[model samples]
Target: ELKVEQNPLFLSMQEGKNYTIYCNYSTTSDRLYWYRQDPGKSLESLFVLLSNGAVKQEGRLMASLDTKARLSTLHITAAVHDLSATYFCAVDQETSGSRLTFGEGTQLTVNP
Candidate 1:
């Protein structure tokens, strides 16, 4: 069965600090995605990595894909209180479009 796991389900981050969130999957996936969700708001897509060695970054967030190892990671650089939110890593399943198995959401708190 396909599964995804994330480290430190709850993170207390300090301002201007850097941290990396790890995501590991159990099955093969052609695409891996990262998303951020603010309280009471719909998720905002962060990164989409396709193929091994794919990487993408925007603002202070970066994500990478390693298909051979069935892993994907979300790295936070220079975290700020404004960046506090819940993050989720997801990957397409053997099924089809937008059908993804997701990790239990990670709650990130960036304190000033």
Candidate 2:
């Protein structure tokens, strides 16, 4: 079974502050993904980590994965009010077909 855990389930920071959300999985996974969801909105894909040491960045957000450690991280640089949303990390197990196990989302609130 694959289990995922995310820390700091709720985060409150000022605009321009930086923070990192971590995801740890109990079993091996080949693919990892980061997603964002606004209140009353569907999830939006943020990043995809396909291999070990994979890293992707867009705007003020960066995501990295370490397959060996079964860990993934989403780093937010200079957070803004617009970036306030629920962030999630999901792991894809090959044996599970297209099914993905998601971590408990982190609800971020960026204040002025």
Candidate 3:
């Protein structure tokens, strides 16, 4: 069984629209995180939620955590071409290095 799950593996958002990505986990343990990958680029760290009600945002991306419910959300406000990429939310397995268990990944495309 997978520890984490994300819906709408592919998200096509408009240039000036708002959308929210969802991340659900099986149990409570390590922290949850959000990351963005641009094309062939590496993962860009967005948010690291250690506990419930932890919210963070930068630019057009906002992320919130709900550790009690085992859920997280990444909200995108007013999408743009530069935001077109893949977003992935992962959860650590409470290990020494805190290895991540990632969702399938959401591919976002912002069309003009």
Candidate 4:
């Protein structure tokens, strides 16, 4: 079985500060994804790490994957209030038949 775990389930930080969210999986995975969800809205795809050592960045968020270590990281740089949201990391297991295992999600709050 594959399981994903994310640290700092809840986070509070001031605007302009930086933080990193970590995701660790129990098994090896070639694909990993980062997603963002607002209070009541659906999840929005932020980054996709398709291979080992893959990294992706957009705006103030960056994501990276290391298949060998079975870990992925989401880094937030100079966080803003608008960037406050629940972030989740998902891992794709080939044996799962298109099912992706998701982490519990990290709720981030940015205060000015």
Candidate 5:
């Protein structure tokens, strides 16, 4: 069974600060993804990590994956109020085609 977990289930961050959300999984996976969601809205894809050491960044959000450890991270740089939202990491099992198991998610509130 594959299980995904994320730390800091709830985060309160001030604007202009940096933070990192950690994601860990129990099983081996080659693909990992990061997503963001706003209140009452669907998730938005932030990054797709396809292999070990794969990294992607956009604006204030950066994501990386390490398949060997079955771990991934989402790093926030200079977080702003607009970046406040819920973040999630999903892992794709090698045997499961297009099936992604999502983490509990980290709800971040960026205050001024």
Candidate 6:
């Protein structure tokens, strides 16, 4: 069975600070993804960690993957109030094609 989990499911952050979100899985897979969502809004893709050691960044957010350890991380740098949102990590089992198993999202509140 494949399982995905994220830590610090509720985060209270201050502007200009840095933090890291972790994603752990119970199975072997090379595909992982990160997404963000505003309250009552749909998810927005942040990064796709396709292979081991793969890293991606956009603005103050960075994501990396380690398939061997079944782990992935989303790093936040110099957070701002506008960056407050719920973040999620998802994994794709190659045999399942387009199906994705998502983690319980991390809700981030960036206060100034």
Clash statistics: count for each candidate: 0, 0, 0, 0, 0, 0
Model 6 scores a TM of 0.96
The global C-alpha lDDT for each of the candidates, from Candidate 1 onward, is 0.90, 0.94, 0.89, 0.93, 0.92, 0.93
Off by over 4 Å in 4: none
Q: Mind giving the per-residue lDDT tens digits that candidate 5 earns over 1-112?
A: 8999999899999999999999999998878989899999999988989889998989988898888888899999998999989999998886746899999999999999
Q: Which ten residues in a row have the lowest lDDT in candidate 4?
A: 91-100
Model 5 stretches with alpha carbons more than 4 Å out: 94-96
Per-prediction RMSD in angstroms? 1.1, 0.9, 1.3, 1.0, 0.9, 0.8
TM-score-superior candidate, 2 or 5: 2
Top lDDT hit? 2
Indicate the residue-level lDDT of 50 in model 3.
Answer: 84
Cα shift from native, residue 65, model 4 (Å): 0.6
lDDT of 4 by residue, 1-112 (tens): 8989999899999999999999999997878989999999999999889998898989999899889889899999999999989999999888657778999999999999
lDDT of 3 at 53: 91
TM-score of 3: 0.93
Better-scoring candidate (TM-score), 1 or 6: 6
Error of 2 at 50 (Å): 0.4
* Model 1 alpha-carbon miss at residue 16, Å: 0.7
For TM-score, candidate 2 versus 4, the one ahead is 2
Q: Which pairs of residues have clashing backbones in candidate 2? A: none
Give lDDT tens digits, candidate 1, residues 1-112.
Answer: 8899988799998999999998999988898889899999998998889899999989999899999998888889999898899999998886645688889989999999
